[model samples]
Target: MEGFQIIRWLSSDDTAAVYEAAGPRGRRLIYTVGHRPAEPAAEFSAWAERLRGVRHPHLAAVAAAGLTDDARPYVLCDTGSTTLAERLVHTPPGVNEVVRTTTAIADALDTAHAAGLRHGTVCPSTVVYAADGTPQLTGFDMCAPALVKTARPGLYTAPEADPGPPADVYALAATAYVALGGTLPYVGDPTDPALRLRGITELPGVPPELTGMLRTALNPDPVSRPSAALLRDALSTVEVPETVTTGALPVAVVGSDVRAVSSGMTTIIEAVTGEQPRIGREKSPPMPPGLAPTRPLPVAPPAPKPVRAKPVTSKPAKASGRRTGRRIGVAVVVLAVIAAGIGGVWLWRDQFAEATEGSSAIERVDFNAIEFTVPADNDRKVTLTGGSATSTNDDGRAESWTLTDGPVFADGNHNGDQDTAAIHLVLEVRGSKRSYVLLFTWDGRPKQAQQVVNGVCDVTDMRSAGPGIELDLVSANPFADCSALGKGDTRAETITVAMRGGFLMETAPHEGATSRCELAPGAETRAQDGDLPVRVAADAGAPELAEDIDSVTVFLPETAGQIQWHLARVTLADGTTTCGWVAAADL
Candidate 1:
């Protein structure tokens, strides 16, 4: 501080002044100090020392710090030409420029946090623009206590400091907001001292991605904000490309005129003059692979020559000269007539040749137009064959058939449900690989259908079943009723079954009491019987039961009710049993 001299005043309100200082080698560097009268001299000295330890591309490097001659405390840092605020006001910066500046500031905060320091003050004015237009952070007088505790008017202060990371995040976000257009999201004047002190906590207008990030940074709860390193990582993902605006072209010409011309005219002019014309019509110069064409120049036309005619001579001899002149004139007339006749015939023949050539060119046409029309209905019908069916015995009997040569279908509406009518059937079989699908009419009600190939039901595979014959469910919401229809062993014998139509049914509860219930494959319950598990008789014929019957899970309330069980002994026979239970408060 003793070897420093004030060269210029940067700002009166913030008491930022530029000074020149000589180091041990007599090398002079511009040093800046914030002249805050409110800060004690000793506290300011300590804050400057803390900042001096921080090194980053964005933050101004601190050279020295101490009490001035008049008992005033000052924090010395690298002095630069302008502030980011001044740059924004004077020169238009692109999004890339803004991103570069903001990233620098973020890096500075990272370095400060690493050095056990936090920038208490972060605002547009605090960011100084270097001579090369790079923005650097300055002013560390208010950096004591690690983070800002009390609200400083017109300065962006974090919610809490307490030597934590969140405070730094808030300051970084404030700097970023200023870098990107400097407009607050909320309805308030950003320049107002009261509003600025309040900080940009709620920026709903910011992009959702940026808003989410800044929200974390500006979290009122310091514990929620990310650390400086984490903030830098987050900023890395921000796609801060060059700013785009209507008419935000790079070159700034105060008064410029632009015009358009036809490509045909441009080509003709360019050909005749050998000069490349403007308006992007100049023929590209022959270029080697990967090389670009050089800018074309206009060609100059040949200068015209001045002509001088021979003087006419007056006739001298009268008689002999007159007779000779008449003979010569007659001969010239005869030769002119003959030449005119030949030229006429030649012109007529040339016209005829052109016409013939034009007609012949039509016959040798190089291209033809082809048109295609889709039928209004756009409906197709298809039938598929060749599938195998197998039966399984769990607590109950169940059967499964799988097919793998049908067309793939989609809901089209993306509602996570399947459309049965949209199901296209396999048409004219080209080969095993390609299966044609036919479109059906859409019914108002929800229809369930599957693109049945050879007979293997496609369902979600939790594990690796094998290669080439995997069963998977295309729909996110698989049918609860159809869950058990895909489990079975593949046998050699083929089984044929037609689509028997599908309908939605309310699942019956296994217990008599009404409660939440689930169905397991190869399990069924009788409507008449209570909650009793019935065993099927081996001698009884098979009952005509649903295709997939898993175990029925019933949530029973503690209420007195009758429960029923159905036992399917065979394909066409069934027996029922009933029981009763009382609902208990605690079961």
Candidate 2:
């Protein structure tokens, strides 16, 4: 590119080196050069030419093209703002903003495909939000001849066209899906190289209109998907309002920065008060009668009549002194016996209750209304038969059942109680397994309880012998080496718990048994050795597995709240890896 000058190298992938470049007019453009060997470079250049031929306002324009110092073929294109992924973490766009962006990209894809060029890479990283807030499709490294070879992951690829136009359409839809809400259409192995490929071919439930378009675009039969032009036109017609208001924007965005700020604020508050900030507001109930409102002191009534003492005037002083001494001694012995008896009874009662209540509290929870069903290959649904679990009385009894189809629930501030304000029911359902837990105080008690199955209680503060394993997925362990994992990325690592407490891996690349593995963003894996197959995803932190381990030990911090991990399968280009639960005990 004669008009483009490379400022500095930014980053590189297997196929290309991305550089910060400035155009002749000084406009910033990302200059990407294909890795040597000529073939890939030629492919990229031809693809760039094809994209340039099909002009789309939402697509980056190919400014210039040629070789660099190393004779590596390169293309200069407009450098939009950071990727949508970065923006979502720092400042997520409103739902309406997402809709508009998605619609624009869809239109661009439709137009490009109509002209026979497929915008191959359509992940969040490739989609950039321009300074003016428009979403633009930037990368075209994988773009191929529309009628020749399929270029992307099969999950996100279309079955028809050999490498058909519908495949691009599927990618467009997938990209839009993520843009709408930063989650994938299907919840599966994020590390699996095959996931995107599978997503391309499968028709997952998306927005109704988008869903229909994707269905057409992802048609296994090439003839069934809409042409790029037609798809673009269809997307253009999508009636996305200017904005979608999600009640109120959260105080913080949906990523680590917000979390860090919140944590720091909490630490500062706690340092000043010497106590952790309560999750919910605290309110004191009204005081009872006869108690002083300010200090709870009981008022004494006037002294009784003193006139009766006058009649008992004078008796023998010696008789009076002896009688008084004898009475005092007897009273002291009686009081001692009574106190001892009371203490014995209290101790006996406590022991008896402990023995009888063993494992009974978990049984008291009612799981009759809980239903489990698998709707897809790697997704599960847990439905409750009722609207919500309500308890009219503050006795630790099941009053109502709250049914949530997903892992998150809104904390409804009802009863004008601020302490109950942020209490939400968070459910984590993966594959065939189902678990429910109350996210707030149950029955006005400070002791928070989690429901492992339907009625069983897994106290977060203590481990119990329940059906689910009580593994702390977020505890820090200094002994385990987790350096192999990348920073700021989340991935699920499979831990196998064998019958003899010996752990074995079905797949390897973990070079050492004591080595640590970092989870890739959105990475999920499935546990293969457990009685029930569980899906696990790394939501935070790099966890370490010990060498020659049969049972995977997850150390949880005492400060950790409700944490969950779902098993998923990680499939790479070479092979698949499956990891599951160490034991079936609930936490």
Candidate 3:
């Protein structure tokens, strides 16, 4: 290790090698070497660089990261002597311990999420307890495409697409379930995404409220999962019986954060091979036009390995059986097509917009081929051909509008099918611009249906919200000056848009209710009902954590018992301040 002494190797798997290492100043640290990808070292370094700035007390900070002499990606991080996985093997965590530990982890995750980072490999292995017994999260930014394989790394992975923030929630919930002594929900082939989506088995002895929250976190639809901050709040309110904390293992240990390489890793390698189909094999029916194959065939079928309830250990995990064979000869033909570049889209679109039969044309249409119209000066409209348009003003100042995302299909037309497509476009002018959501309908071709401008903010993500569209918006602390907002400044909020009376409009709050405010952290507001108490927890029955509040500065807003509550720092009448949950109705 670079300038570090490897005390001993803790674990070695096909995915990574974990070791107890001594870093600068003899600081005990855990070093990891994950399976290298074909991509350049700079790409891995870039991600590691990003993780360096994401700091939290509960997050294991990346001390150093780079490639080894052999080009394997390695990271040195702060950690405790043992991992959550090792602790679980002995004593299952009591309900109270699960809430406290998971809440801390979720809060830590929320901090990273706010900075636009994701802990793609969250699991028992990544959650390591500190010397004082507080868990700290490790393995940030380790889920490179090549490393993401079957569900075997840990049984707690999101089933839908590549791991994202929502996936992290699912992983945390699964980890908590296991800590509470629940059986691993997944069975059958480790590489199957369908197994992850089979729904979690009920956890005996768990509080109903906690179980319900976990159910939502494990929903097959990622969009429906709550944010890390929301989950933390909900978990805090869970009434778990207070019990003695479990004892730690005497010997030191830590688990690898990277997913172990297995059958799925080979699937990636096979996709790019140049092998040809054997001659004289029985012919199979051809795929319909416009549809593309998701994966290519392996050069050879791998031997089957029995499923095991193995926590990612110090040994290399065995590869599962070759993906249920698809007529051996037929696989060779598909691989040949991939080898010839005819299926180039398969490389990136493996999980992009999976449009199945009976889906609307909007789901399958080529967004790049559609032309659009954008606003220009003096009520003029600039026709954008090929997804972008640029114009020069009389003063010779160049302005441009380019499509950034979308073709997001939703049933905005009141029809049974999701025929309306929403595309996102960004304007670059004088370093001050906003995004627009352009809605289009297909009548033999894409036709403009409606257009809506996003409030002066950055669009981080967009997805269908029933018959509407939900946009995750991010802005700087002082949002009034959008130009000052740099890439790393990350205060954010979400908004939804829907079609009302043949026009796309921002969805309003229910009649007598107010929507969550887009207030910056520490934004001050006055309390309306001073008599109402601010509780220590989100639940109404929880003890008051703050007293004699004069005013409050709110951070995050959430709902409990159909009432809105703001997690706020309350200023007392005597000039002292403390943080607690303040009801929206009281504020």
lDDT score at residue 79, model 3, on the 0-100 scale: 65
Our tally of clashes for model 3 stands at 0
Best by lDDT: 3
lDDT of candidate 1 over 1-587, digit per residue (tens):
22222211111122333322322222223443333342555655566566666677777766655554544444445644444433343333555566566667777777877776765556554666654567787655444532222433222455443534566567667656655544443324424444434434433233557656765676666777787777777767777434331111111111001100110111122222233322212111121122111122112111111111110000101211111111100100000011111111001223233332322211221111101011111121111122323333222334222232222222222232222121211111111111111112123322222112211122211111000111221111111222223212111111111121121111111111110022233444323222223221101121223322232222322221332221121111112111121112211
Candidate 3: residue pairs that collide: none
Worst 10 residues of 2 by lDDT: 307-316
Give one clash count per candidate, in the order shown: 45, 50, 0
The stretch of ten residues in a row with the least summed lDDT in candidate 1 is 328-337
Tell me the whole-model lDDT of each prediction, alpha carbons only: 0.32, 0.34, 0.50
Query: Which structure among the candidates has the greatest TM-score?
Result: 3
Off by over 4 Å in 3: 1-3, 11-16, 24-26, 34-38, 67-72, 145-154, 188-204, 244-587
Task: Tell me how candidate 3 scores on lDDT.
Answer: 0.50
lDDT of 2: 0.34
Candidate 2 lDDT by residue in tens digits, 1-587: 33333333343334544444444333546655555534555664576567668676788776755444454565567755345544443234555566567677777776776666655556555666554556787666444321122233323443343444566666566555544553443435433544434433322323467556655565445566676567667766666444442222111211111010110121221222233322212122121122111211111111111111000000001211112111100100000011111111001223323332322222223222333221110122233433343332122332233443221111112221212101113222121111223222113222221111111111111111011111111111111222222212212121111001111111122212211222223333222322232222121222223223232223332322333432222222222222322222332
Q: Is candidate 2 or candidate 3 better by TM-score?
A: 3
